[model samples]
Target chain A: MSRALGIEARDRRRAMLLTAPALVWTLVFFVLPFALMAAISLWQATATGMIRTWSLDNYTAFFTRPAYLGAALNSIEITVTVTVLSVLLAYPMAWIIAEEVPRRYQRLALTLAVIPFWTSYIVRSYAWSLVLSRKGVVNDWLAGWGLPLLDLANSRAAVVIGFTHFFTMLLVLTIYASLVQLPPNLRRAAADLGAGPVAIFRHVVLPLTLPGVMVGAFLTFALCIGDYVTPQILGGGKDLALPQLVMLQVGRRADLPMASALSIVLMALVTLAYLAMARWMKEPGK
Target chain B: MIRFAVSATYMALIYAFIFLPVYVLVLFSFQDGRFPIPPFKGFSLRWHQAVLSDGHLMAALGHSFVVAVLSSAVSLLLGFLAARGLAHARLRGAGVARGLITAPLSVSYLVIGLGLLASFNLANVPLSLMTVTLGHVVINAPLCFAICASAMGAPQLAAERAARDLGAGEIRVMALVTAPMILPALVAAFLLSMTFSWDEFIIAFLLSRFDVTLPVELWSLLRSGLNPKTNAIGSLVFLVSAFAVLAAELALRRRA
Candidate 1:
């Protein structure tokens, strides 16, 4: 019995040994850094250096400053628009690939759909800049057709379009996974109950895919809100997103306190989003 | 016939939207003029030649490769060990440990980058490739752990037990049995991490100095001018990443 207990003890020790490096790495790197950031957010950034005053001055500044508050609001508006537009556009594309395409070609079709995602994200945003610029391809085409120029190059609409492009592909993959997992019998059962195609889809398909849509939308919100490159490239400094504001704080002013506070605010938004979608974000089996 | 036509038209429009930027980017990379916009002057390889000859850009590319490979390797090792340990042993607070390990996956890269930048500032650590690589591992190890943990299941557990019963030492059981059993997952995790670390921008941007990654270099280039050289480099990156993605897809499909 003592030998068995010894074995148990040794197993536990081995487990600890094996997991220790990663746990310690996480604690030291991820958790500690986050703690330090949160702590620094309370400090004040002066012209000379950071003042470790341990106060709410930075947070208060974030609330009181119009530019800071506007950046947050702009981030929310763009993120919400991107998330909703992505879901609406991706649902049909995902449905087409899952239900309309042949089984052998579905994989190829999906791959083709998301191929541009592998491009350097910075480059992708820059490409959008080129497309939306005054003398760029879109305007040139419009001129060829004798239509008015879009005037979209350096605007919030440009940012939203760039974001929607990326997130639509992401949502398509997630919603496709959910749609494919749904057994065909559920649809057949609804059909046999005298439901038409639209009725069956509305009653059965939409509910079953809600979790996937929610997960994708949450992901879109999280990523889009924190992104710096897309808005910095596409929005052209005329409008500022939260991330660009954070970058401006760090890069130009060297204001770690302000940057930390802005980052925490950004994280708070993502946390709120996660909490709202927590119920539907789980894996289907789990 | 009308229904079929509508479906085809919709698919065509969506595909066109999806491929528009890529097409424009690649097409203008071969533009002969200084401007990358329309009125394609004609096809030329001057921009690609220019990118190849640029010393800073070449150095940044090398830095990106080294950081991506080394950071991904470290992340894969740590993730594999933690995953194997969690799967094989019944430890206290396993759920919490798992959560801690994988928590970085959900956080934005910008926040992670900012946090690291802040902490490094507090610690008086100078910004360099080493710091950038460390930041990459923090962002990527969680992904590696999640992938590896999901791939560990009953069949592998039985094999591990058999190896242990046959008098294999703990190290041998892992090296000889478990590693080979989960080779596909390990490779997948490693490749995925490499791709992410390679493409990661914000972390490397905030953490590095003097030795910038490709993305940062490209950002400065984009900021400096509106040249087709940026298009050339961007197209090159796209081609390389596309090749990697296709190879990974083929490999994973073959294994399945």
Candidate 2:
């Protein structure tokens, strides 16, 4: 029995040893950095450097400054628009891929849908900038068709368009996974009960796949809200999202305290999103 | 018939919308003229040649490759060990450990980059590729851990037990038995991490100084001016990454 106890103890030690490196890495890199950021957020930024005095000056400034608050609002607006548009657009594509496409071709179709995602994200946004430029493809194409050119470059619309394009692909993948996992018999059963296609879809298909939609939407919110590249490249300098604001504070102002506060705010938004979507974000079999 | 037609049209439009930017970017990269905008001005390889010869861009590319590979390899190793330890051992606080490892996934890249930058500054560690690589590891390791942990199952546990029963050492059981058993997961984790690290902008942007990554270099290039060279470099990155994604998919499909 003592030998068995010794074996168990040794195994426990081994497990600890195996997991220690990762734990330590996460502690030193991830947790400690986040803690430092939170701590720095409370510190006051002075002319020469950060003052050790703990204050709410940065957070207060964020709330009181119209530009800062506007940036936050812009971020929320863009994120919401992107999330909603992505879901609306992706649902049909995901539905078509799962329900309409031939089984053998479904994988190919999905791959083609998300092929652009393989491109560098920064480049993708830059590509959008080129595409939406005054003398760019869309305008050129419009001119070809005798249509009036629209000014989209460096606008919130352009940012939304860029974000929607990427998130649509992501949402399609997630929603498609859930759609395909749905047992076909459920639909057949609904049909046997004399429910029409729309009714069956609304009641059966939609409810079952709502979790996937929620998961995808929440992810979109988390990513889109915190993204600096998309807005910086596409939103032009006319408008600033929260992330752009954070970068501005860090890069130009060298206000580490303000940047940290802004980051904490952004983190809080993501945390709130996660809490809201917590029910549907669990592992599949969980 | 009308519903089918509508769906087909919608799909076509969406596909067009999705491919528009990629199409424009690639087409303009070959433009003989300076501007990357319309009026193709006939195809030319000048921009591609320019990208290939530009020492700064090439150096940035090499730096990106090194950071991606090293960070991804470290992430995969740490993730695999953690996943294995959690899967096999009925240890206390496993749930907490898993949570801590996977928590970074929910956080944004900007936030992670900012946090690391702050911490590194506090430590008086000057920004370099090493710091950028460390930042990448911080972001990607959680992802690797999640992927590896999800792929662990009863079959691998049984195989591991069998190896142990055969008087194999713990390290041998892990290296020779468990590792091979979850090779697909490991590959997937590594490839995914590498892909993220390669294209990751914010962390590398915030951390690196002289040895900037490709995305950071591209950012400066984009800011410097509107040149077809930017288009060429972007196209090149797209082509290489697309090839990698295709290869990974093919490998995973074959394994499955």
Candidate 3:
């Protein structure tokens, strides 16, 4: 019995040795850094350096300042619009790939849908900028057609277009995973129950898939809200999003405290989103 | 019939939308004139050659490759060991350990970047490629852990046991038996991690001082001018990364 207990202890120690590196890594790089950020968020940014005073002055400034508040609002508006539009757009595509395509070709269809995602992300946004620039293809085509050309490169419309383009692919990937997992018998059962198509969809298919869709939507919100490049490249400097605002604090202003505070605000928004979506995120009790 | 037609047309249009920017980016990279816009003067490889020759862009590409490869290697190692450990020992609080490793995935890159920026400043660690690589590992290790952990099932565990019972050392069992058992997950995690670290922007942007990743350099290049050169570099990166993706898919398919 003693020998057995000794062997068990040795195994336990070995396991700790194996896992300790990653656990320590997370604690040092992720958790500790986050703690430092939260601590710095309360400190004051001064011309010389950060003042050691523990106060919410930076947070207060974020609330009171129009530039900061406007940027946060812009972030919220754009994120919501993109998430909604992406779901609406991607659902049809995902549905088509899952339902309309032949069995053997579905994989090809999905791969084709996801192929563009492999492009360097910044280049993807820059590509959109080129497509929508005033002197770019759309406008050139418009001029040839004698239609009024749009100056879209530096606008909210452009930012939304860029984000929606990316997130639609993401949502399709997620939503399709859930859609494919759905057992076909459930639908057949509903059909045999004398239910019409709409009735079957509303009662059976929608309920089963809504949770998965919500999860994807939550992912969209989390990703869309925190993105800097999409808005930075597409929105231009005309409209600053929250991330751009945070970068402004760090880059031009060299205000690390202010940047930290803005980062906390961004995280707060994500935490709130996670809380709202917590219902769908729970695993089914097995 | 009507529904099928509508769906077909819709799929066609969506595919068009998806490929539009890629098409235009490639097309205009060959624009003979300075402008990358329409009225495609003619085809020329001048801009691609320009990117190939530009010293800064080339250096940034090298930096990106180093960061991606090194960071992914580290991430995969740490992740695989952790997955192996968790799967082997019935240790208390293993759930919490798993959660801690995966928590970073839920956080945004901006938050992670800003947090690291603050930490480096507080610790007086100078921003450099080292710091950027560290941040990439943080973001990517969690992904690798999830992939590896999911692939570690009863079959792999039983195989490990069999190897151990045959008097194989712990390290030997892990290297020779368990790893080969779940090679697909390791390959997937490594490639996925590499791709992510390769394309990661905000962290590399905020962490590095003199040396920057390709995306950050592309960002500055885009900001510096609106020219065909940017299009050229962007197309180059896209094609290279796309090939990596296709190769990854083929590898995984054949392995499966």
Candidate 4:
């Protein structure tokens, strides 16, 4: 036999041995820092610096001040809009690639779809700002059509467009992966059972791909809510997103405690997103 | 068919939408005027040449490269080892270990950066390129681990078992058998993390003092004014990244 008690012991030991360093690294860098931040969030940020006294003052302030609460609400609104919009846009493209494109060309088509994302993330936002600016390309194109100019730069709409552009690329790859994994015979079998194309798509294909869509949507939400660059460059820093508020606390005010509090709230939002995705994912299996 | 025509038109419109910003960015990088805005002047290469000569941008490029390479290497090594372990043996609490290792994937980069920043401030650790690398690893290592773990299923386990049955030592089997078997995953993990680190901004911006990465430098360049040099550098970045993605796809396609 290839397996024995001694070998089994060795295998288990080796597994532990192998995972130990990575676990240690994660503990030190990822987990410990989060723990530290949690502790610091409970502390107070004085004018001089951080103080050791435990207080809920930052969280209390976050609730009491309309600016902070409004930023959080705006972050949620923007993230949801971008997530749902990108998924809607991307699902069709991914479906086309999976269903319409020839097998050999599908790889190239997918690569082309995601190629724009390879650019510097910050540059992508800046480029969109240029395109959405009053005197930028969008307005220029409109002018050629004798249309009214659009003053979109430094607006929430500009931020949503930039974010949608990136997230759509991401969602396409994901949804395509799930789409291609469906066995061809399953669809053929459904057809043989006399199901119409639209019916098959709704009942069979959509249900199967829902998990992937949810995962992509959750990723979009997490990334969009935390992103400071898109809103900073395109939203023009006039209205602060949560990340911008956190950054302002750290960069201008040097309030580590307040930043930590803001980050904890950000983490909480992401955790809620994760839970929701997990709940939705469980339904597809049923 | 009407359906075919509809799909075609829709695809064309989407492609136009996808290419819009990139088209403008590249077109304006060659604009002959001071402003990057509309009313396109004649083409010129002055901004590209000027960006090439900018010392701070060049230095940031170098710093980004170093951080990408070094952090990716460390993350790949850790992730590969952990994946190999989880695949080979059933350690008690293996799920917990795996969860802990990959937990960072669920967290946002901003929150990760803020956590690191707060901890470093508390500990008085000076923010530097190393700190940025540390933050990148925290984010990228989990991703690397997930990719490696996914690629280490039945085939890999069989190969590793065959090597062990033939009397290969653990180290030899890992180095000579298991690793080579998952070499594609290792390479993919390394390359993908490099791409991420090279473009990552917030962690770099939050964790660095004097020596910033290219994205941070580009952000400042963008904010300092509306300069075509920013466009030039951005176009260059797009060019390199597009080439990398094309190369990776071609390589993987060939293998498949």
Which candidate leads the pack in lDDT? 2
Pick by DockQ: 3 or 4, better one: 3
For DockQ, the strongest prediction is 3
For all predicted structures, in order, the TM-scores are 0.97, 0.97, 0.97, 0.95
Give lDDT per model, in order: 0.90, 0.91, 0.90, 0.88
lDDT of 4 at B12: 79
* Clashing pairs in model 2, backbone N/Cα/C closer than 3 A: none
Please give, for residues A45-150, the per-residue lDDT of candidate 2 as tens digits: 8888798888899999999999999999999999999999999999999999998889999999999999998899989999999999999888999999999999
Residues B84-113 of candidate 2 have per-residue lDDT tens digits of 888877999999999999888888989989
**Between 1 and 2, whose lDDT is larger?**
2
Clashing pairs for model 1 are none
Error of 2 at B178 (Å): 1.5
lDDT of 2 at A272: 84
lDDT of 1 by residue, A28-80 (tens): 99999999999999998889878888998888899999999999999999999
* Local lDDT at B64 for model 3: 96
